[model samples]
Target: MLQLEGLTRRFGANTAVDGVSLSVPAGQMVGVIGRSGAGKSTLLRMVNRLTEPSSGRVIHDGTEVTALRGQELRDWRTDCAMIFQQFNLVQRLDVLTNVLVGRLNHRRGFGATLGTLFKRFSAAERAMALSALARFDLAEQALQRADTLSGGQQQRVAIARALMQQPKLILADEPIASLDPRNAQVVMEALRDVNRRDGITVLCNLHHLETARHYCDRIVAMQKGRVMFDGTPAALTAARIRDIYGVSEDEFDTAPEMTAPALTPAREAALPA
Candidate 1:
């Protein structure tokens, strides 16, 4: 299990994540939802050790993640992969090489690490990278430069790279926030597939209410750096949403749907499944 015990982060006088505690069982897909400045991004970053917590502990299956050092810390990061809002691909590199970067942690010694900079990977590793790309339906683009693909395709490439890590947990921060409606659905479905098929635990920070309700097994609502609600999607009713967002009933009614609309049949058929 993944446990966050009183995890808190402060910048000078501002406490970004305020003593947030959560216990996530294995294989659970959880959606962390909240408005801007609610600390959603910081929470995930802290778990991945991208940002250090002010005071608290991050424990995963009895290992005190916060206390890990050097190689241990690097290993923890490898075990817990992170997918960012912007597709963080090496724009100049080919798609296959970018995906192979995930295997860097598995390579021992400085020599092996240096070899990757020149795109020298074993045939078996190259095959594995190809397989991951195929899973995301980007096999044809394997030789293409990452910057040549569309936003949706680039994001899919990013997901394939994360798969190469063979991570136990995935922390996705606003993964689909920049995509168009159809692309957003495709990305969300891809994430759901990973959670179900590989049994990888997913902690995704989402901005859309309906998207979270649709893809997540459970939803965690945060307000002012603290969890205000934690339950299944059905339990996150209209009233609860209103309370979380601090909107009046009429305003809630007038607000736009919190997720991308359904894709048209033609558009759906054109995208990879």
Candidate 2:
């Protein structure tokens, strides 16, 4: 299980995440929804240890995540993969190479070091990466530059890269925000597949209510840095969205200017090591 106990993040005088607490069961697919600046992304980043909390504890199973450091920290990152809105990839690198980056932490001893230094991958690792790409229907584009793919394809590649990590959990922060509706559906389906087939725990930050309702096993609504609602998608009624977001149902459904909230400078530098 993943537990957040009184998790909070402060940016100077402003608190980005305010004493948030929640528990996520293993293999559950959760969608976090909130308006812009609602601290939704910050919460996910904190769970992945990409952003440290101000005052609280994050525990996975029995391990205290906030206490991890050094090689422990690196290993923790491998165990929890993070997917970003921008599809953070080495744009100049081949698609397969980017996916192989997930295996960096698993490499050991001199041969692994030398292979990485020389940009060489073992045949078995190459095959594994190819299989991950194939899962997302991107094997044909494996040799293409990551920058050459469309927005949706790039996001799918990012998902494949996360799968390559063989992680116990996935933290996706607004993964579909930049894609069109069709592409967003594809990405959501891909994530759903990862959750169901591999049983990896998935915590995704989403902008659209219907998208969340359609793909998530549970929906967690946040407002002003606190969890406003937590329940099955079927329980999230139109009136509840209005109450949580202080907007009418239609306004929440057709949000035109919503964007992934930015991180504070203190949190920005806390990216996964």
lDDT of each: 0.88, 0.89
The TM-scores of all predictions, comma-separated, are 0.91, 0.93
Instruction: Tell me which residue pairs clash in candidate 1.
Output: none
- lDDT by residue (1-273, candidate 2, tens digit) is 999999998765667789999999999999999878888988998887777888899999999999999888888899999999999999999999999988899987788978876779889989999999998999999999999999999999999888888899999999998999899999999999999999999999988888899999999998778899999999999888877776876787566434345655666665432
Model 1 per-residue lDDT tens digits across residues 1-273: 999999997765567689999999999999998876678988998898877788899999999999999999999999999998898999999999999999999999989988998889999999999998898889999999999998888888888889889999999999998899899899999999999999999999987888999999999988778999999999998888877777753454345334223334364335432
Cα lDDT, model 2, residue 46: 89
lDDT measured at residue 193 in model 2 versus the true structure, 0 to 100 = 98
The top-ranked prediction according to TM-score is: 2
lDDT of 1 at 184: 89
What candidate 2 gets wrong by more than 4 Å, as runs, is 109-111, 254-261, 264-273
lDDT of 1 at 55: 84
